[model samples]
Target: MTTPTAKRWEIVDLIANRTVTAGEYKPSIKDYLSELTVKPLTGIPVALAVLYAFWSIFSSFAGALVTDGFMVKLFDNYWLPWIQNVWPNPDSVLYFLFVGDPLADNCFEAFGMLTSGLFVSIGVVLPAIFIFYLMMTILEDSGYLPRLAVLMDGLFHKIGLHGYAIVPAILGLGCNVPAVTATRNLETKKQRFIMMVLLAVFIPCGAQLGIMLDVIPETVGWVMLYLIIGFCLFGFILGKLIPGGNPEILIDIPPYRRPALQNICKKLWVKTKGFFINAIPFVLLGILFVNVLYLLGVIQALADLFAPLFVTWFGVPKETVGPLIAAFLRKDLAVAQLSTIAMTPYQMITAVVLISIYFPCVATFVVMLKEGVKELAAAVGVLAVIVFLYGGLIHLIGILLGVA
Candidate 1:
């Protein structure tokens, strides 16, 4: 063999024979699912079905089963009555601050730090977020989220973002605080800013969603329609106006695998822990702050002053001012408060939408500030304009539809 010089082709074939080993390949079900989820033809309907299931489970388990069937009865029938009787001195400032209205029948009407705060945080929001995080974790660990991102990439690009933007958008539905941080995954400053603003304005947190299902279940669909419209409309405008590069990104889609129970439990625990530490305090403090403002006559004064703007422009009542103020601290609490106010169904819809879009909760605002004070300032400015324009636009739509 050494005596005979080998041709280059023969040497190349010898190397290939040693290196490459061909085998029969059979596609697995996981492979078929992966393809079905990423392609446009099949993926869109699958995405719709998945989201519908998500919403259905979130509403039924969190809203109906846990909160309505259990928490409502527990808090309203037993807890509220017991607290009302035992809290001592219903007339005292401390009593009012902690227990709210002396004769109120339910936790939602109580408005006290200890009464409504605990109820809203534990009874309503906790279940909602738990279910949301559970489903979200399942979607994430099963390797479906990346495929969702890929499917959404084309639509998102029209708004100056890649497919990955859906991650933050979905996160925002649970809570905007984490969603603001999630924007770091975006490639450019403009994308982050747009995402932050959109999240702050358009996406209602799980707490709000839970309460909405409880309070305005019939009209929640309309409210959501308006929000989705605003999200895309402003996103497109920002994509055109903002000065930054929207670059393409490479997404690494992992093979489908069974989500490990240990991993899901770990993620769920971490998320629940975050909500307890970051959100519960705010819910309690929000009630306290609003109560103090009420006692100080600030809420009444502001309501009187804003009566013209709120009534004339937003097509909502001046009383919405109080809830709007509370909204700064917690939008869910504000929505709950809004339910107590007297308004036409249309006005109620507008007021709730206003509360949803007006400003990010203090927690979200703080996180945005941490991202960059300058960015925060700019976001606030954009928010102000969006509130004015979009609020008026909704009112205008209502007027055209004869609903305002």
Candidate 2:
């Protein structure tokens, strides 16, 4: 060890096994890029640009080419027709389940496991899932996400959440189930509850985003913008409303490095495979549940039951009641159901918005309950109020913007 009185410039160079005085090298591209991401003045813009690029690639390009161009044609032109041709009887449960009422002129109207199920699951959602995960994995592997968390630390601090809360928020974009579990990373019960509530209410998972992009391509950005704004605003509101002391962020930021292709592919495959494995069954089950409800005339009963709430208050059709119920099982499927309904853009926007905020899926609900029963109950109550309030108010916003 060096003496306490040693001069600062006389430090030892034992690691290199030499008495080297100093070393110097020019800053590399990675260092320059790091500077751009860490500085407050430039970091936010860079983050926005990066997000915009990912959105364009996921929503516009993959959505248009893979989901719309390929999946839509495959589903509508081939899959639905083939299934319908084989099961043509209007009165049969099989026919109705696979080919819905033939009156509505859209694939979503069919609501079959092979028709809308295949269409929404394969056509619209698959591309979005793949692209969003691909970009997300890239970001994760590159060490940029931590830098982003650092950059947003100030804003998150004001919300009574630390920058690390961004982890669950980012995870939520992939799937809310895991995201809810991720809230355990927070130090306090109140923080976990707040994070869970905000995520469940505002953050649209990748699968939901995928279908939304496919159906309402032009308005997805605006819809996403609304949700993102709600995320921060509600986080701050919850910070104040809930009794808790805001904690300072403690995180480690790693140097930027090129992501390995093999690791990226492995992670991408694992996440996407998990989503498909978990979500597809729920999608199919939702279709079957909808069919059973329809056959029993329960759908009409539900439609009537929620008509005043969904139709009068939210400005969406009463048929949305089925999708709203489906949301309890799977939100992406609920969003998929919107494609079949006849509605103005305003109605569709409100429907998607409500679907996102109405409630967490069964998986997330269980996780939240496991985290804290009382808190989960409070969260459920809050969800009810928000779903109705935001769902109704968005229509007015859409009308004022003249998009309705």
Model 2, residue 308: distance off in Å is 2.6
Worst 10 residues of 2 by lDDT: 7-16
Best by lDDT: 1
Candidate 1 segments whose C-alpha is farther than 4 A from its true place: 1-20
Clashing pairs in 2: none
lDDT of candidate 2 over 257-329, digit per residue (tens)? 8899999899989978887888777777788887888789898998998888776677778999888888888
Residue 232 miss distance in model 2 (angstroms): 2.7
Q: On residues 1-404, what C-alpha lDDT tens digit does candidate 1 reach at each position? A: 54335677688899999999989988999999999999999999999999999999999998899999999999999999998998888899999999999989999999899899999999999999999999999999999999999999999999999999999999999999989999998999999999999999999999999999988888898899999999999999999999999888678999999999999999999999999999999999999999999999999999999889998889998999999999999999999999999888888889989999999999999999999999999999999999999999999999999989
Instruction: Please give the distance, in angstroms, between residue 394's alpha carbon in candidate 1 and its true position after superposition.
Output: 0.5
lDDT scores in order: 0.94, 0.80
The true-versus-predicted C-alpha distance at residue 105 of model 1, in Å, is: 0.8
